[model samples]
Target: MLNLDVVWTSEFAANKWIMPLPADAIPTDKMIPATVNAATYRDTLVGAPYYTDGALFYFRSDLLKAAGIAARPKTWDEMKTACKAILALPAAAGMSCYAGQFDKNEALTVNFSEAVASAGGTVVDAEGKPTVNTPEAKKGLNLLVDGFKQGFFPSDAITYLEEQGRRAFQDGKLVFLRNWPFLHASLSATDGSSKVAGKFGITSIPGTDGPGVSTLGGRNLAISPFTANKATALEFIKFFTSEEQAKKRLALSSRAPAYASLYADPAVVAKRPFFPTLLTSLNNAQPRPKVVQYGATTKAIQEEAYAAITGKKDTDTALNDMQAKLTELSAK
Candidate 1:
């Protein structure tokens, strides 16, 4: 039997040395939903969640206070004000996600998906119909695209990956950042790697007065169907994913756990300053479409966001095209 389910998770760093554990470590919650288009590995009661991640707002407290802002922005309009405030202050860049650069690209997809849903738009209809061109989707795309074009964020941001953004913000090149939980450790560590240590704050992703939404952006644990020692796997999972471990992940590693029980632990929450904000966003997150076509549709939506912003296409017309593409893609 494998001694432990996950000796090292992809969360800390890419699990290259420990990439493929003998078993799986995924979640079984119906709400978590599967990502692949047609089928998913069984929603097995896989290994315990070491840590999960979601959308988080990264900002520099020094810069914000200097600009006379005392609190995080709560709504989309306020987000605009905050972005503009930071941009107007020389050397403080603001950014959300890369526009339509790559698909399955966690940062871009989650950022765009969350913003769309936060604006009260559903990616798929009740009948599993595609709805990427709905009014809410249009507004969501415009929100980021406008920021991109007008330079609310760094001009080079669209070409950046999550780590690239992390480096930029840590280097003081950016004042506002929207990224995953990993930034927590990278920025706060006493280690000299980050230039902006102990100076940043986190908040829930801003909303638009409609409803706050952020996409699910982390991995869950699952046992492999081929495992010969399921019980051992489960045992290892429990040990590695206990409350104590979870807290360590929050403090030392910056990973979130999916278990509701662990969330109530004071130590766990305390270590992760953004725990409350993440929970709020998690509570409101809309699961991605379950159809086999979901991934392809997401790519289409990315194109729509870019077209509406950089392609010089009419916003309404772009949306219309998106709606059509979604309809065709999601069709049986």
Candidate 2:
């Protein structure tokens, strides 16, 4: 039986449960721990990275070839043109990538933040202030709205979850898709659930200025300062993060390791062909703002910014309100 209740650190800052983790057992980077963001870097090395994953662009190769383009776009402008060209085809239904309805709350914020990075922007200004209202963010949102208006983006995406959008691509309607690395297991499953498996190509989300970009936050295992099993927890971290054990854990679970090494395995590379491209993207990846209030700020952007783009609200009014909201949020 499980020793004690396991709650996401995001939900509870200090959890008390079970003994320390086993020597070879890996920690959950995305889910485990309590406030590793504030705990890991400042207080101590509370958790070590296991395997990690992030946003990867997946597309339909057959469609690209038919469109007279054989290579994946290495630039955002090219990506936009590719989207438009694909949308113009007789098979055009809509683009079903992460550009979905902006639902899935936290994930969407992470998604939007990633978009900002791709455009060579960031969530906070250099002085440690939120920059969601900056011109780059505006440019990024305008691109989303442009697609939404052109019918390349779905009207229902605002309501769809990541998995919901993932399954939708199987409808054979989407020309492209974006998701975390976990799809390697699901997409290749022989369960007969996916229609486009073995049919789509994967790449990085081409960057607007340089190449492409991916957000970087891997699952980490951290013991709550309140945990009674500190020894066991430390032991577990050592084992799980071990180069040997990480490879095994990754084979068994969807969670990725945080190390920069395990990515070199032939098996890992073969399965995730876009791995190399994603690594390059990772080099330029930026972490989310360190503030605890990041979660709330992102929510405001989704509900407000996405609404404006989806036609639920006017851009000028929505953006003005966003600026006011950020200003108010910062003052507090």
Candidate 3:
């Protein structure tokens, strides 16, 4: 048995290193559809969906209330308007508008994919074809590029990874931050380490029109092809992914559960106040490109996306180059 990253499903399946899962025996019916999709490769179910995660929009709620903003922004335009109001306040004097991971690393690929998806575009289509050359894709990439050019994102954000962004938000240096669900516990801590302990709020990341899509992330449980005790492995997998176990895990460790019902459970919500918003983001999440060559695919995205975000290349030129690179990668 192996605990595999969701992005590795296609790679492992293509290499014949993992056996296809017996869908009838697994409790996939109760799992999040996006997680089930992540465990699938070329129409074959290859892994059992495990705990899952998605990006969330983290903001300084107190700042929004002070600005008289009645609700969280659901669209990019609304976010910009809110930023204008919040930044003008004396309390928000040193804060920047927003920030996401933009360094030339794997984080960049995740951020880039979410941007395209939120604008109603895809980095790669369902059939494994590159689709980053469309008008929607351009609009998506422009959100980051234009954000930097307009000073919405801090100038130093080009060097930020997850930790940097989290630190900035926890320190009350940002009005909004795009990050994963795990940050909820840390940011909500009452320790003196968090400057905005009770002042922050979470929602679905804003989109061009409405709520944005997040990049799906999590691990999957798979049976190794060489394992002799296949029956035993399957039994363990069933036990591990069962609803009872999932609920226990969530309660014990705050790990996001794959079971959809847990997100709505009163007890679960009482323990994790962010579950409802997280469920909304997870339902709209898109898996990062599921290809056999995921490593090279993500590298290509990071390079082009970094260039565009840092003003080294215009959005069109960067995405055009990315399209060609992805086209070649898919063909391989």
The lDDT leader among the candidates is 3
Q: Candidate 1: what lDDT?
A: 0.59
What tens-digit string does per-residue lDDT give for candidate 3 at 1-332? 99998889998999999999886978888989999999999888899987999999999999999999999999888999999999999999888999999999989998999889989999999878999999999999999999999999999999999999999999889999999888988898897889999998999999999999999999999999898999999999999989999988875786798999999999999988899999988898889999889999999999999999988999999999999999999998
Error of 3 at 23 (Å): 1.9
lDDT on C-alpha atoms for all candidate structures: 0.59, 0.59, 0.92
Q: Name the runs in model 1 displaced over 4 angstroms.
A: 1-51, 86-106, 221-253
How do the predictions measure up, each by TM-score?
A: 0.73, 0.78, 0.98
Off by over 4 Å in 3: none
Task: Report the Cα RMSD per candidate.
Answer: 7.1, 5.4, 1.0
Which residue window of length 10 is worst by lDDT in model 3?
A: 248-257
Number of the top-ranking candidate, with TM-score as the measure = 3
Over the stretch 282-308, how does candidate 2's per-residue lDDT look in tens digits? 555555554435556666767776677
For candidate 2, report its TM-score. Answer: 0.78
Q: Write the per-residue lDDT of candidate 1 for residues 43-153, one digit (tens) a residue.
A: 222234444556777777776786788876777677667666765765454433222222224346566767778777776775657787678887876777776676565
